[model samples]
Target: MSEERETPERRRERLRQEELKRNPAGSIHGGGLPDLVGGMGWKFTGILILLLIVGFLIYSLFFR
Candidate 1:
């Protein structure tokens, strides 16, 4: 067989080159704020709400 076998390093380099080709130089990483919000979505909202509730409870218990 005349085909050359790809080694691990070669495979990694190939993948990186392919990624670079797909993503242009001007393109930014991730989806920025909207992407983060969408990815976190309900989970982040629920956590923040829960934290606020717990903090209020703690404050009320100690200061009221």
Candidate 2:
């Protein structure tokens, strides 16, 4: 490596480029569904919904 140190702007640019390389052009974040899938994925979401539905049904049957 060269003895010359990188400036803040240059280091920031290099990190930005690396981040772009890691993510695709259409990568999105922070919406409800996007956050859901990003964290636990669609399969987990489906399972969770299924359990909630089953729990609700059992609660209604016995308590209501």
User: lDDT of each model, Cα atoms only?
Assistant: 0.65, 0.66
Pick the lDDT winner: 2
With a 3 Å backbone cut-off (N, CA, C), the pairs that clash in candidate 1 are: none
Model 1 weakest lDDT span, ten residues long: 30-39
Candidate 2, which ten residues in sequence have the lowest lDDT sum?
Answer: 26-35
After superposing candidate 1, which stretches have Cα over 4 Å from the reference? 1-40
Clashes of 2: 0
Please give, for residues 34-57, the per-residue lDDT of candidate 1 as tens digits.
434444557777897799899999
How does model 2 score by TM-score? 0.43
